[model samples]
Target: MSVDNRRVDASPSPAAPPPPDPGAAYAPGPARPPGPASRLRRFATPVGILAGVVGAFGYVATFDPNEPGHYPVCPLLGLTGVYCPGCGGLRSAYAFAHGDIGTAFGANAVAVVGYFLFAAVWVLWMVRAGRGKPLRIGLAPVYWWGIGALLLIFSVVRNLPFGSALAP
Candidate 1:
């Protein structure tokens, strides 16, 4: 018998079956495995952050900022004969750690404040991480600008002869 090419085979056949339902065909994909990279990141990030905090405080505990050469000299101060705002931070931290608040303030009031700020922020970060939440601070544009201006002023002041006390 000759087959009719023009006529369509509309009827469902006994042997050949219809395609499965789209909904039924899709089984929920198996829960994705926690990949190696993600696992590494999860463990590494928090520990690194914590280690940094501890290392900072540890340096403050062990070293006296008043003494020279424990920390590296500020290249900016030496090279340009100008004091950067950060010149005496390590010494300030050492003073603050040793309960010589007056000396810390004399060394660098701003760095002392920064050390406390870092401690507080790190505590907040640890608390949030413990609760399975990430800690993030997004300052407003005005605040950022203000911070920049403050740093600039500090740099300028520390370099001036009258601001010698603020210098290292």
Candidate 2:
């Protein structure tokens, strides 16, 4: 018997179907075409958010929360005889809007931090929106729990005699 040494699998295979064109995905496939409004639509949400924020801050800046009958008392504080995390949020906002950082912090240090945090996140959201990218706040469960715990601690601490400094 003669032994054959030739390789059986060296034959050229069909050129892989031209790689699904990378640009094909972007090609307007004769379907609904993009228009000027589509570009503007991307900005609508972010701009609306900013406008609402500005409007709210404007109201807070104009109307004093410290004034009687302007804002309602916090229900939790009213009923529970304890300071809730948001007990003085409006006062903090009012103080912050008027550039009284010290009073804002005195009212609610956590709320002051929240104000700065919101500002930072809003700036980031605007930048992403302007770039046509989605602004996602995908915090993990752990982060959420940490925030809850921090608030809980703040609530408890403020109600204690030692934490009067944190009271609204």
Query: Among these predicted structures, which one has the highest lDDT?
Result: 2
Off by over 4 Å in 1: 1-48
Which digits, one per residue and each the tens of the lDDT, describe model 2 over residues 1-168? 999999899879878766676665565557875554465787788778878978998998899888989988888878979899988888888988889999999999998998789789888977877777778989999999999999999999999999999998
Among all candidates shown, the one with the greatest TM-score: 2
Number of colliding residue pairs in model 2: 0
Per residue, candidate 1 scores C-alpha lDDT tens digits across 1-168 of: 987789778887678567778777675769887544444454466679878867887777797756776777789877887778787777777777778888888888788888778779877876666665667899999999998899999889877888877776
Question: What lDDT score goes with residue 112 in model 2?
Answer: 92
- Candidates in order have lDDT scores of 0.77, 0.86
Model 1: residue 21 alpha-carbon error in angstroms: 23
Mark the 10 consecutive residues where model 1 has the least summed lDDT: 34-43
Question: Which pairs in model 1 have colliding backbones?
Answer: none
Q: Supply candidate 1's per-residue lDDT for 98.
A: 77
Candidate 1 TM-score over all chains jointly: 0.65
